[model samples]
Target: MNRKVIVTCALTGAGDTTGKSGHVPVTPDQIAADAIAAARAGASVVHIHVRDVETGQGSRDTALYREVVRQVAASDVDPVINLTAGMGGDLVIDPANPTVALEGTDLVSGLERLVHIEELRPEICTIDCGSLNFGEGSSLYVSTPDMLREGAARIRELGVKPEMEIFDTGNLWFANEMVAEGLIAAPPLYQLCMGIPYGAPVDAGLLQAMVNMLPEGAQWTSFAIGRNQMPWVAQSILLGGHVRVGLEDNLYLSKGVLATNAQLTERAITIVESMGASVATPDEAREILKLDKVA
Candidate 1:
């Protein structure tokens, strides 16, 4: 329990949570402010996703990303920046015509999804491993095997560490296959996402099994949404992995208490410290994840 734990604060996700919690930052300035605060509060990394200023919904606009990164880069703190390349894969299918996509769909090519990543060139970007029923609807997050392969190879070529996002056992299996094919470079990094609908449930035994399935020398982190956020920090640490928390996954710090990004990160640090493990600094996290520090 004397290990150093890397704490990643996911500032804002592409989920429909902006209305649910006032703490969820929408504009670039707000997101950047939250990131700087979280880093000052002892988070090792900041996972970012920009939102449209007017609609308050998630956006893949490179301009929005540019603004957010610019603000954070100009800030005093220097937490490792981890951009979300998991956007542009959402496909909300039409009920009658399954072949035709619905309005909510933002489906695009795998390379298209990396447009922002290519421009920003952050230290870390995410590639969701496989497709899944995103939530309790006709929505399906599409990341086909071919798409994943193309994305991984591109990310590797760009010299950005790709965080293989494992939603379920199938995603993990495909990720291993990518490693075997030498698409993912040495010291691969993974994020074991749990408790999302139609994905891996929040079960310790299942998490242990997934951890066991990971290739040797792989660096991994895990997180669950809603009430499971705080508990999953200990769960990930106990299983020898890093942790992520923030408004993206959970709105409340406790029941009936809406929490900000900084608050969640502070609580995560407390948990890590209480368990006899120290929270990793940004540099320490870069070393652990084998990331090339952006200058």
Candidate 2:
């Protein structure tokens, strides 16, 4: 009962789930609305990823990001805004010529991926730690060591805390190196992404090992996709970490039930409270994470 958990609800991700669930937000207005609703539902933070309004695909458009941030900041309810700076790393290789990048490829420099983050300067932004074979396809997510070093330094300069995204043990190892090198500030933030194909498998032993490897005083959280989502919430809390939920990593409230951002947030709160841990408010989360109030 002495624990206070920060609940972050990722409103919409840059995934291909818009077709699978009608509740997935597409436009800036929808994303903003979802963010506000999630805040009202007891979420201390809202993780955002804009999408192309017409195509409903994930986008890196600065304008779309500006609009979404504007609406959320202007709203009555306050939640720590965390933007995704992990875009522009997709590399779909051509089957005919392995050296050739495919049409769907959006590979760019790590700095290029931070265009919006550089402009908007939210309280927090994510930095994917390493490259990985993204899912079952020719697609690969790239973030080399050089790219990570540059990106981490730039984010520190911007006064935006970088949420180091750890997809595997190797990623965690490199992230620890960055912390040791003084690129990341005190109390480094980490997001242990589990159940993502070709990354870290959904294993509790692996999660515990990664937790043991974290830098001392590091603030961390873990999440799994699909049905494993809620269970991971309990697991993360049990292991002395925060929690993240929403359409980004999960879509169902129960079997055959699609969930909205707010619904997922409420569910996460229920889990937290039932576990004898209270959900932190926006201001409380800011203090816990050492983030300045941007909005």
Candidate 3:
């Protein structure tokens, strides 16, 4: 096996992990610092999602994204920046009314979601492939087929590579359809988002099934949330796929132990090396992902 695996460190995600983890970076400075540190530690790419500093909740404000991108780009450490365009599509419908959305519903147009990507023009951005029941509750992430096509088109126009995020088999199917429709560029980059509630399970069989759904010549990575994060690093690389890790997907280095983003990335590198796979450098990752050089 050619032992070169790319490592993508997802910084603080949009999830509510602020009070849970002591190392989740809330402020722009902290997030940027952690990103740089993860790069130095061995991550070739850093996936970012900024949070409202005051509330530690995820925000789609372009200004906030600009600051995060600027800080990461201007820093001494250089890693390919991948901003998330998966926000602003969450829909929490009221069970009682069924017609009215709940207070937590945040629905924005596809164009509105890409505003930051337009301004920053980061080398890469995420385009969620399809929607799924996020959990057992009434919450459903609303990434309709039309929305996916629109977002993919806009990202392509902006010269940003779209990392198709697939959380289930249907999402993978939709991703293939997107490629067939010419919405996504050739050799589509995919991220198998496993272990999320109501999504694909973290078991090997499901992971392999999702991988088998990829189009020919596709470049892909796989990650699991929470406890499955670290283990999936080994699973992904072993399956001839790439790996992603960070505090965003997981908060613990071990049982009852909180981990920083850098620590999570370092652990991933260790796993790769242990399996006779070398961690790809930032430049190597750029070439593999076909990202523009870091500015």
Candidate 4:
């Protein structure tokens, strides 16, 4: 077992989960506070996704992202900032024609999706490595090869680490090739996203197979959704990788108890400690990640 692990708190996701739980951070201030609170609770990094305050839906606005980063910078805690560059790839199709793009479809060039990342230049950003039917609807998320190549190249120029988001085995295959082709930097970071709809199933065997396929010396983390969230913490650690947690992936501290970002992080700390491994601090995490400097 790896004695030291990095616990990243994905403070807010672009999911329609705000109505389901009051703890999900919506406003910029709330999102930054959640990141700081998670850091205090033992998370070395914080993954962020801004939401529209009025609609409580995901947004790719640079203004909202600026405010969130500003607030976190003002705070004493300096947890590594990870901005979600996974927006602007939604592809909702019209059932009748298949050729017509529906209302929810928000496809844009890969560079267009990186507007916020280009401006904020956070320490880390996410790039979904492949396209998939996002959920149980007409919605699909598109990230084609050409898009990935362009996005990865731009991210390299900005000197920010791109956390490759792999939703399935095929996505992993493509990610590995991106690294091989030098589109992604060496020691690429991969997020083994599990338990999402119509993608890779959240099972140990699948996780193991994905892990086995990883390029040598790759930095990796994994998480699952709903009740499986907490269990995957131990699973990731046992597999010699990091873990992520927060309102984005789960909302409950227990079956009936709702949880805050800090509470969820505190719980993750308990699991890591109980397994005889210590959690890494922010500075330690930067070193572990081989980051030359923190933004």
After the best TM-score superposition of candidate 3, give how far the Cα of residue 292 lies from its true spot, in angstroms: 2.4
> Among all windows of ten consecutive residues in candidate 1, which has the lowest summed lDDT?
286-295
Tell me which of candidates 2 and 3 scores higher on lDDT: 2
Clashes per candidate (backbone, < 3 Å): 0, 0, 0, 0
Per-candidate RMSD, Å: 0.9, 1.1, 1.1, 0.9
TM-score of 3: 0.97
Query: lDDT at 62 for candidate 4?
Result: 96
* Model 3 stretches astray by more than 4 angstroms: none
TM-score of every candidate: 0.99, 0.98, 0.97, 0.98
The digit string of per-residue lDDT tens for model 1 on 1-295 reads 3389999999999889999988999999999999999999999999999999999988999999999999989999999999999999989988788999988999999999999999889999999999999878799999999899999999999999999999999999999999999999889999999999999999999999999999999999999999999999999999999999999999999999999999999999999999999999999998888889767
Clashes of 4: 0
lDDT of each: 0.94, 0.93, 0.88, 0.92
* Model 1: lDDT of residue 85: 96
Candidate 2 error regions (>4 Å)? none
**Ten consecutive residues with minimal summed lDDT in candidate 3?**
286-295
Predict model 4's lDDT versus the native.
Answer: 0.92
Clashing pairs in model 2, backbone N/Cα/C closer than 3 A: none
Residue 72 error for model 3, in Å? 1.5
lDDT of 4 at 30: 95
Best by lDDT: 1
